[model samples]
Target: MKNPFRLPRRASLSRPWRWLVPLLLVLLFLAVLIWLPWQARQMEANERQEQLIADTLWVEQTLRFELARSEEALAVLGADLVSKPPTPEQLQARLNQMFKNGHELRRVLWLGADGAVLAHHGLELPPAGLAKVGRETLEMARLTRAGRYTEPYGASAHAPGMVDYYLPLFKRGEYAGSLVASYSLKVLLDETVPWWFAQDNDLALLDRDDHPIAERADGGPGRGIYTHRRALDLPGSSIVLATDSVKGTPRLLPNLLVGSVIVLALGLLLSLMTLWRHISRTLAAEAALRQQMAFRTAMENSLLTGLRARDLEGRVTYVNKAFCQMVGLSAEELVGKKPPMPYWAPEAMKDYEERFAGVLAGTITPQFETVFQRSDGVRVPVLVFEAPLVDSRGRQTGWMSSILDITDRKRA
Candidate 1:
């Protein structure tokens, strides 16, 4: 004989599905939630590193441009020195004026074709002289009949370091003389680098050997998390501009967020399992009625969307976990609350009133948009879907709302 107590075939097939599908969904959701934050953090780190590289290139170009400008200005002086034949006293006055304008330049000198100093400005002429100290660049200038920058020199225990720029003077294919401009690396950085940029990074001028020539660190040394190096394309020098940013890497998730997710997930899993066991034990007593209520409650609690149920009298009869968390309030503070809800945005009061009126008049717009203010005063945009709440007897009892926080969707 067919057993009178046996479950229907369809019901037996669906039994595992009732619990298993939700369990798999929860696990999948957890994996996605963890991955999204980690991926975002990685992107943020790469963006910061890229930004540092771009800014370092900009500073390098700025320094190069300033030096090139000083080189051009010296050429104009050399032309006058060759053609007009200004007196030593007059040339000295002009060099002083140039010094006032070219902040990067430490000195200026005029060298005859025979390598004798004609007239100079800013500090006494060095005892060793340019011919012996920076012979390669000076010779290159004479042979090419063009211009060149000397290798940086004089950074010893007794003297300060400087770079020399030569603007060769040629008259009818014959080398006449050259105008030489000197640069202090320290002054070049101080005058060329912007204050705001320097304040956020440690900038160092490095030689080919990676030795620090000069440095500017307004906000102290970097944490080494974000850094970049760019070379200044000067022929006689392999000076690199290196920057270390003060900013650090972004965190993947906050402690509060991780803790909350863990606690909520554990609680949900435990509640579902407990309810499942209770239903298993009482299935023969009131299978239809108890099974339906248990399934509905567990499903509602597991949702990420906020759920709300109201009695026909406009009183809040129930609220789910997501709703309380969405508004930054506890469930006890939200349940049984009347109109003028704490979560309602004051600026959207009229909109809320009209919607509440519709709920009381036995009708509701199937779906609509609204804003809710969190307890912290942050506004959250939401899309709400409303339907008629039905009783076990299939009679309409109240209004049910499924609220989805659409802040991310709206932002996108």
Candidate 2:
């Protein structure tokens, strides 16, 4: 007969799909790991660009403010000269005071209405290059009759980067002389750009032609530099203030940290995947074992043979439903009962006890005939088969008995 106790075969795991899932997960994790650091660097570069632009604007505003202050000072002096023309002694004294206070101004001049130098300060002899101005620039000042700044130019043989500030003086509605102030580009940058600002970056004041008038000696922008430029709004001038980060845009340590975090996350994900695989296999095995146990239980319940088990000391440990029916008792009443069991006939109690004692001593019988009294006091002849109940370690821990009632066969 086919063994009905055999369990159904468990479904096999899909090995390719099983490994492919984690493989795809690993690939995704690696993609994110690769992308994170690049993203961080790009963001850092953008932030650096923004910061450079802001610094350029700040430098532009600072230069504008300083130039305005200097222009106002020249306006005051021009007012004094127009209201009452001073003596040569008074002019020299006032100019000396102004030069002492304003270090950015390299020279000062009083220009006649025809652009001829009337008086000058700061240099014993003015360079030949400083004698004339562009007629168009001079005419603009004369027409505006207001303070204006000239485009940056080589002011003297000694100073290549100087600009002239002009304040046209008008006395009684007639054009008078003009008060001119020459500003040194180097001196202006020194007074305008902060010490801290120049430490981390290279700053430069560029003329209209993009020629650097004054520059800080922080190394030029190499690879990965962020640069920004803003115009310094001065009258009749197109001066640009520019800044650049000398050490490049993205910082190294932060990018390294971001990469480290991504690596750790990938490692953690791999660990979780490993743990999940182990758990999945374990659950599959448990399900298979449970199914096997359920099949065995169903086969045992359907058996016609009576099954009984006794521990090493001859105490009944287990009895199946068929055994209870054969003894005319419930399993609860028969299981855990000792030798001289309730179903043993009163006259055969001594014989049954001796047989049970031999069974506890490891004696086994393949088959024997016995008589058991039912609950109604009727005697039933039964054929019994006995065997050792061995555990997984091959140790005999108990006895198992199979019994078949044969009253009808005996009568026939």
Q: In lDDT terms, which candidate is top?
A: 1
| Tens-digit lDDT string for candidate 2 (1-412) | 1122244565555456766787787779778777767777798888878877888788788888887877887888788888987999999898888877777888888988777788888854345544355445667788998777778876344554777877888889999888878888878887778887777678777887788877763455423377778888888877888787776656534755776877788788778778878878876877787787777767777888988888898888877777788889987787777867889999878778778778867786668888999998999999999888888999988888999999898999
Candidate 1: misplaced stretches above 4 Å? Answer: 1-18, 131-133, 155-161, 254-412
48 Cα displacement, candidate 1 (Å): 0.7
Question: TM-score of the candidate numbered 2?
Answer: 0.73
Per-prediction TM-score: 0.61, 0.73
What local distance difference test score does each model get? 0.80, 0.77
Report the C-alpha lDDT of model 1 over 1-412, residue by residue, as the tens digit: 1111234434542377777888798778777767767887899899989989889989999999998877777878888877898887887787888888877788787888887888778867666666454677878778877777766666654444577777778888788877878888878888899999998899887777777777789888988999999988886667778999998788867467765876677777788778777767766555675566666767766889998888786778788878888899887787778898999999999988898898889888999999999999999999999999898999988888999999999999
**What lDDT is reached at residue 301 by model 2?**
70
Report how far off residue 119 is in candidate 2 (Å): 1.6
Per-residue error (Å), model 1, residue 343? 64
